[model samples]
Structure formats: structure tokens, C-alpha cells
Target: MNEPLTRQPEPEYMDLDDEAVVYAEADFADVNAAFVERLIELTPAPGPLLALDLGTGPADIPRRAVAARPGWRIVAQDASFAMLSIARRADRAMGLVQSDAKRLPFAPASFDLVFSNSILHHITNVEPFWAEVKRVAKPGAAVFLRDLARPDSAERAHAIVETYSGREPDLLKEEFYRSLLSAYTPGEIRGQLERAGLAMLDVALVTDRHVDIWGTVP
Candidate 1:
């Protein structure tokens, strides 16, 4: 019998200048904007939300979120110095931290909101990622995580990439395909969340190629 599809892990960090540039240049404007809007709508009520963004590569999502809600105080965290440097160069985005997602340099229960976009699949050891999320978020903190869903096979992954990134640069398209291969399935991520004591959050497929794990921390 053929084995079920499995996640193909990729590098956890994009520390090189050219890699960071290729990623930062990719057009994620529509999806990133949608992520911010959906996150805002998910919050029960909002006034100066103290938000934490994990794996905030290039700082695009945080910047868009802050622009939509000026009261939000966001701190973007990434392990890649090159990515953060590009983010700063783009607009001098402040409060950026270059740290691994597993080792967040923040106090416990410190944030009203915790969110990440397209970062989950990059994590090789996902337990610490969710554990840190649960640890740093305040009680009842709104949590929204969006990531690509691993396709059933390489062919599907390539098709998804081509459909979405047809006009994108070759480098970007290749990276997108690799990311899809590396992304975790919904069941796998849910199990990870449960093991990390985050079973209360909801996990569901949000799109053909994406999964959204959302809801509030208990």
C-alpha cells in the first residue's frame, strides 16, 4: 500500500540576503491584508491590543495590521537577521526582535493577541512553537495562526504554486512549492497544539491550500 503523504521539513530560518530579498519581494499584499482584517474581526473587542507576531518575516503583516488598527502595539519577532534588516530598511519598523520563535523574549501572559501567518510549516520542532504561543499569551488572548497545508503529493504542491504564483519570480515560485511540501497537515498541527496544551483552539481548513487555527486561549 502507498504510504500517506508526510511533511517535508525545510530550513527554519532564511538568514541569507538574497533569500530574504526574494521572499520580501514576493507580492503577498492581498493575502496579508486579508489576514490582518480577519484577525481584527476575530477579536471580541479591541482597544490598544498588545499583539505579538511570531515569525514576522519582513514585517509586512504587522505593518498592515497596525495601519488598520493604529492603537495596536505590535512586536514582530523573527530568527532571520536578514529578514528583519530588510523590514527595517523598508520603513524602519520598530520593536523588531531577532529571536527564534521557540524562545520568545517576553513575559508570561503579556499579550492580548498572538498571531502568525505562513510561519508554522517552517518550524521543524513545532511543540516549542505552540508552547511558547500558549506561554506568552495572556489568558483569553485571541490567537490566530494561518499556514499552508501540505498537499497530498509533489504534483499537487507544484500545481498550487503555479496557480497562485504563476507570474511571481522563479525563486519565489520554487520557495512556495517547497513551503507547501514542508507544511503540516491539519491533523498534525492539531495534535501538536493539543500536546502543547492548546487544544482549546479551533483548527480548520480556511482555503484549498491553507489552514487556520484560531480562537482564544483559555
Candidate 2:
């Protein structure tokens, strides 16, 4: 019988200067582009938009999003100063803020869209994080979040890492395995959504290794 995967929490922030820079420089063009494209497809709203991209590691998604939808005005926020500093170097018209996801600094209803990619598993207290995401969103705001899904066992996780990140360096492959171990399952995420009053959001396994939660706030 396969061992059940247990949730393993990782550091909340990727603040190490060297590591953050290395991460920011890595080639994530394909995945980042796909995320931006999917988000745009999910939200067909026209005109200028005030959007928030949480855990905006290197701000690659925001950069792609703005290029595709010129009307989007994104504020890329991250808790890691190292990550944000790297993102700051790139000339961008959108805003950037360094704040905790559980206690965002933005005002209520401040964003037309509140979205994040792969930040949920890092949070220790996800209920507050979900509430914060809900709080910052405008009425009818679109909420889109995506992150890895924990596999059933360490072996499965390792196989997944090898399949997807085989060409990547050992450092990234190790990190990817850790992230997979730390990831939340779709069922667990559904329970989080229920408790956080975000039950309206749909939680689904978007890919073999990732889960997606999305819906318009009521």
C-alpha cells in the first residue's frame, strides 16, 4: 500500500537574497505565460482593471498579463523582500507592496481582481489568508488561485518532480519536491474555502500536480 502524503509546511517567505535572485532568473516562461493566459480567459471583463497578484515572486505573470491585456493595472505584491527587490529592478507601471498574505495592507474592495499562484501552501494559517484574499476583493471580484497538489506518497512526488523538472538544476528539483510535499489537496482546499466563506469558489485538480480555485466573489 502507498503511504499517505502528509502536509509539510515550508518557509512562508522566499527572502534569501541569493536564492530569490536565482529563482527570479530561472526560465519560467512557459508556465508563467500559461497562467496569465488562463487568468485572462477566466476573466473577460473589459476596460481598465485594478488587479492584485499575490506572492508575485518575480512578477513574471504580471508582466505577461499586462502585455496581453494592456488595460490591466496590476499591483504585484509579495512578502519576500528579496523577491520584491528583484521584481522592482524591472521597469513596470503597476504597483508593488511587501505585506503578509494573512494581513494584507490594502483596503477592502480595493481590487477588481485578486489572484495568486502557488502561495497557499506556504501559509501556516490559511484561513486568515483566504479571508484576506476575500477582504481585499471588490464585490463581484474574480478570485483565482493556483498551487501544487500533494501526491499520495514520496515516491509519486519524486516521480512527478523528475517528470516535470528533470532538465532543471538539482536545487530547483529539490525545491519542487519540497513544494509538492507541502502542497494542499483539492479536498483540503475545499474545506478551507468553506470555513473562510469562500465556498463559492470552485476547487479542482487543474493538472496532475496542481489545483485551482476560482470564482467571482458574491
Candidate 3:
């Protein structure tokens, strides 16, 4: 059976009393930290790189990258004021902006590196996300985005949750399950990328439950 799509973003997610702590305590920071390491290795840009991080929940990825690379100026943005509030409390180094990813407040080609973590699945229509990613990114800008991949069936989704979030609290396990259902498969992401004129990006299954879109903007 096809898994039903379910997405809970921003206010609704933040309204949950456990949401903040769940994200704060989750073990996924290591995964995002690895993405940052890989991005630095792949990006050809030198020091003082201007970067934009979309949907920066608590700014964990930005925090990791900033600590490791002092020269990176990161503008971490999220649509949810609640999430931004949490991000602000987590780190003061990043410039936190509350803005929609589809219609960013910046000018064209404003950044050298654009990245996101697990934000794509929250978007119902992903075309706008890719369009905006291309618009804000400079020519040859490195992109590293990763998100959960929807399973082929609800049973598979349940199994994935059991495998990855079983040890977590009930709230987080449920949240992970919902995110998995909302996510797009690798094939779907490839189609969205092609439609958005981002066909050059490399779309791959980076993990059992996640798909990654990584490459330089053309």
C-alpha cells in the first residue's frame, strides 16, 4: 500500500511541548555534521564563504560548520518563528532569518553555498524549493541537501522508524514516522530537480532512509 503523505511544519510542530527537546536531543546532529564536512571538501571556495542554510532547525548544522570553519558566514533561515527562536538560543554566531525558502528575501545569486537538512520532505510542492535554491545560489555554488526518503509502503515506514527511532522517546519516533511518510523517493526528487532546471545535481540514496541532492550549481 502506498504510504499517505503527512507534513507538520512550524507552528503546529512547535506547538507540541516535546518538539523542541526532541530535536535538541536527537542523534541526527552527527549526520548533519558529516554533511558539513563533505561540503567543505567538495566546495572549491576559499575562506570567508557566504552561505545560506534553509530550514535551519535549531541551527545545529550551522553551528557545526561555523565552529569548524571560522571564515564561513552563514545565514540560517527557517519559516517558523518558533524554530528560529530555538536556533537563536542555540547559537549567536549565525545570522538567523525567518523567511520562506520558496521566496527568499535576498537578491539573485546571493550565496556561494546553499544547504539544507531534512527540509525537503516538509514541502508539499518541491518545484519551488529547487527554483529558489538555483536563484539564490551563485554560479558554481556548491549545494548539499539531504532529506528522508518515503518508503514504498507504510509497513516499510514503520520498520524504518523501528530501526532508527526505536530508542527515542515516543514523540520523536512518531515525528520521524510522519516525516518519512511525507518525504519523496529519490526518483521523485530527480524529476523535481529536472523540472526546476537543476538536472545537473547528483541525486542519490545517501542512507537507508534519506536521499541527498549534492553538486555544484551550473
Each model's lDDT: 0.89, 0.89, 0.82
Q: Kindly report which residue stretches of model 3 are placed more than 4 angstroms away from their true locations once superposed.
A: 1-17, 44-46
Query: Over the stretch 156-182, how does candidate 2's per-residue lDDT look in tens digits?
Result: 999998889898877788888889999
Of 1 and 3, which scores higher on TM-score?
Answer: 1
On TM-score, who's better, 2 or 3? 2
- In terms of lDDT, the poorest run of 10 residues in model 2 is 85-94
Q: Write the per-residue lDDT of candidate 3 for residues 110-179, one digit (tens) a residue.
A: 9999999888888876777789999999998989998888877778889999987789999888888888
For model 3, the run of ten residues with the poorest summed lDDT: 8-17
What are the per-residue Cα lDDT tens digits for candidate 1 across 1-218? Answer: 55656778888898888889999998899999889989989975757889999988899999988888888999999999999998888767457988999988999999999999988989988888888999999998999999999988887888898899999989889889889989989999889988988889999998889999998898
- Candidate 2 residue pairs in backbone clash: none
Q: lDDT of model 2 at residue 14? A: 89
Candidate 2 local distance difference test against the native = 0.89
Q: Measured by TM-score, how close is model 2 to the native structure?
A: 0.97
Comparing 2 with 3 on lDDT, the higher-scoring candidate is 2
Off by over 4 Å in 2: none
